[model samples]
Every structure is written in C-alpha cells, then in structure tokens.
Target: MPNTQQLQDLTTQVRRDILRMVHKVNSGHPGGSLGCAEFFVSLYQNIMDRKETFDMDGIGEDLFFLSNGHISPVFYSVLARSGYFPVNELNTFRLINSRLQGHPTTHEGLPGVRVASGSLGQGFSVALGAAETKKLNHDKHLVYSLHGDGELQEGQNWEGIMYAAANNIDNIISTIDLNGQQIDGATDDVLPMGSLRAKFEAFGWTVVDIEQGNDIDAILTGMAEAKALTGKGKPVCVLLKTVMGNGVDFMMHTHAWHGKAPNDEQLEIGLAQNPETLGDY
Candidate 1:
C-alpha cells in the first residue's frame, strides 16, 4: 500500500497532468478537474479495492462512475497513473479520435471508464443501478461515484437520490464536489440548491462532510468513513467542500477558469505551484 507521502506525491503529479492536458488541448474544464485531484488520487490509490485488471462488468471489485465527466482530465490522469492505461496516453486528451475525450466515453473502450458522463446529474442513477446489481449478484464490493454540486440542478439527480434511499441501495457512495462555482458563476448565483446536507438527509441518505476536501489526508479519512457507512441500509453521501481551480494561485478563488485552459505564462505559473513529483506524462 502507498503511504501518505506517496499518495501526496501522486496527487501533485495528477494536478500537473490536469494542467498540462487542458493547456495542450486549449479546450477543457480545468477548474473542477483541478479541484478534484486529491479526491481521485486518494480514492484510486488508498481507498478503493480494485481488481488486478480492468473490466467493464466490475463483478467482484469496487466500481467508480464519473457523473460530472467534464472533469475528465483529472479522472483520466488518476486512472492512467493508477495503472489503468498508459500514462503517456494522457497526451491524447481532447484530441481527435482519442480514448480520452473531453468527457469520458465507453465507445473508445477506455479501460477505467464504465459510462459516458458529460451529461450532468445522470451519474447518481447509473451508480444506483450498478449498486442494485451488486446486491442482486451478491457481490460484496461497492459502487462509487462523484458528482458536481452544480449538476444537482438537474431534476434526475433528485429522482436517483430518492430511489437510492427508498430502495435501500446502501452499498454505493456518492460524493458531491461542493466547490460553489460552476460554468455560469457560483452555483448559488446560477441556480441555488440550498443546504445539500439537509436535502440529502431529508431524502433519508446518510451524509459525511469533508470540510477540507483539497487535503489528501482529509480525503482518505473522510472516504474511509464513507466506506464504513456502506451496507448500513442507507446510501452514503459525501459532501466534499473543494475549491474550484485549487492549487493555482490565480485560479484559486473564482469561476473564471471553469472551462478555460491556461495560456503559456499561466501554465508555467500553475505548474510551478504544483512541482512535478511522480514525473509528468
């Protein structure tokens, strides 16, 4: 198992990968992807019980779905670094006919991706279905998913939330990146979904809050807690409070970088903030 420092190094490397991938394409969502680096690293490295090889069925191992797929840069980085695919494949991100599309798609037969998820708010339902399948098949492993807080504005998520609790899909853990900012502006300004914690609890799911979502140790600890909550008759929800465009100084506190790639100077500054640790792709 990787120790704390090793995980931290990987997280830093993943952040570098995100910045480079987006900057290369000159088109991609960097803000949310940067914000989720730690979560993805901690998850694939420490928290998950993954199989030796990749398979779409995920019969006896933990399954992860990226519902907020616009952050494909982070997801693809983690998967590759975690041995799901070639790390150098990251150079193909957002390129024509690459498996690493702007949003993850199964049509390319990507090893780590199970669903096409650029369309927001659909992950919860998809995760619920996988969780229910695990139950029926008597698979002891879990299903995990990540959602953008802003994506919850879609009505389908509430339906999935209600379905998960009502049907007692307790083996799934759904985490929301509560970064506050989205494409339009802050989620509140665009379309306020008040008190996600309250809304989740009201729906009868158990919620775990990771107030320091950017920290590696915090993500591991909080995710371990979320894992422990599995099989307890309620679906688990982790509300991770992250900063969109985390790590880069200029991009840290706003939604301006949501879907924009950094220019040459900006990429240099951003990469300097997160010095390469595990070597860049």
Candidate 2:
C-alpha cells in the first residue's frame, strides 16, 4: 500500500494531469475529472488489485470499470501514474492517433483497460459480466465500477443494478460520483437523484456514504468499509458526495466548466490552488 505522503502526491499529480490534458486537447471534460481525482488516486494507489503487470483476464487481481467514460482524463492519469504505462504518454491525450482517446477503449489494446466505454451506462453491466465470469473461474478477485450521477439516468444502469442484486453478485463494488452537478446544471436541477442511498438500499444493495469526496483519506476509509461489506451476499454502492470541479475555485460551482478547457491564464490560476507535487506530464 502507498504511504500517506505518496497517496497525496499521486492525487496532486492526477489533478494536474486532468488540467494539462484538457487544456492541451481543448475539448475534454474537466469538471468531473477534477472532482474524481482523489478517488481514482486512492483506488490505484491503495485500494484496487492492480500492479505494474496487467492481464486481460485479470486472473488473480481485482478489476475496475469506468462507466462514465467522459471522465477519461482522471482515469487515464491515474492508470498511467499507477505504472500502467509511461507517464509521458499522457502528453498524447485525445490526440489524433493516441491510445488515450476522448474516452477509454480496449480497442487500442491498452494494457490496463479491459472494456470500451464511451456510450455511458454500459460499464456497470460490463463490470457485472466480468464479476460473474470471475465466479465461473472461481477467482476471488473483486470488480469495481464508477458511474456519473447523470449517467444513472440511462435505463441500462437500473437493469444492471437489478441483475447484480437479483443474482447476488456480491463481489462487485460500484460508486457514484455524486458531485451534484453534471454537464447541464446541478443534478437536482437537471434530474433529481432522490435519496440515492435509500434507493440502493431499497434495491437490496448495501450503501455507504462518503461526505468529503475530495479528501483522499476519507475515500480510502469509505472504500475499505465497502470492501468489508462485500461477500455477505450483497453488492455495494458508495454514494460519494463531491463538487463538480473540486480543486479549482473558478470551475467549482457551475456547469459552464463541465467540458470547457481553461485558457493559459485560467490554467495558471487553477494550478495555483493545486501545487505540483509530482512532476507535470
């Protein structure tokens, strides 16, 4: 497991990567990426069953899926920083021929990624399928998935949730980036996710809540609890409460910055709040 200082550094680096990648590409999502940085860093550095060596089948390790593929910047940064690939490859994010597309895909044969996800709400089912396959193989490794609050509006997600609970796929743990704001506006303003915790409970899944979405320690603790709750014949869901653009002040409270790239001046200001701990990509 990564030490506290290393985890903090990793999260800072991931946030920097999110900003730099989006500014370079001029067209990737940053709001969600920034908000989810700590969670991704904590997972790769402390929680997930990942290593420098990766296998497509994940024979003896845990798996992670990004259902809300729009947050690719944070996911790609975390994967690279975790040694899935060279950190320098992050410079090619969203470029013409780069494996780091606007969204993640196994089509590029990326070592760490197993599924192609961009269409939203599909990853939950993909994760469930992988978990079920692990059961068939008698593998004890678990599967984890992340979904956007807005993506929950997709009908496929409910289907996946029902399937996982009905079949008692207890080895999977899924989290929602409950930043309360999506591309359009506040989640409550756009489409209210009424009592998400209660909804999951009513669906027969155990639910946990993490109040501080940007804090690495809090995220780690919540994940540990969720993991412990697993294998008792119920899947787990973490309702993570986060701000849309967590680290950057200007980007934080509005939907305007959801997919907007910061100009040079804006970049400087944003980076000021999150100092460079690990070297920039």
Residue pairs that clash (backbone atoms under 3 angstroms), model 2: none
- The models' CA-based lDDT, in order, is 0.93, 0.89
TM-score for all models, in order of appearance: 0.99, 0.97
- Error in Å for residue 148 of model 1: 0.4
Candidate 2 lDDT over residue span 1-281, tens digit each: 78877888887778888999999878899999989988998888889876569889888899999999989999999888888898999999989888998899988877789998889889889999999999999999899999998889899999989888999999999999998787778889988979988888888899999998888889989999999999999999999988888889999877788889999999889888889998987
RMSD, each candidate, Å? 0.7, 1.0
Q: List the candidate 1 regions with Cα displacement exceeding 4 Å.
A: none
Clashes of each: 0, 0
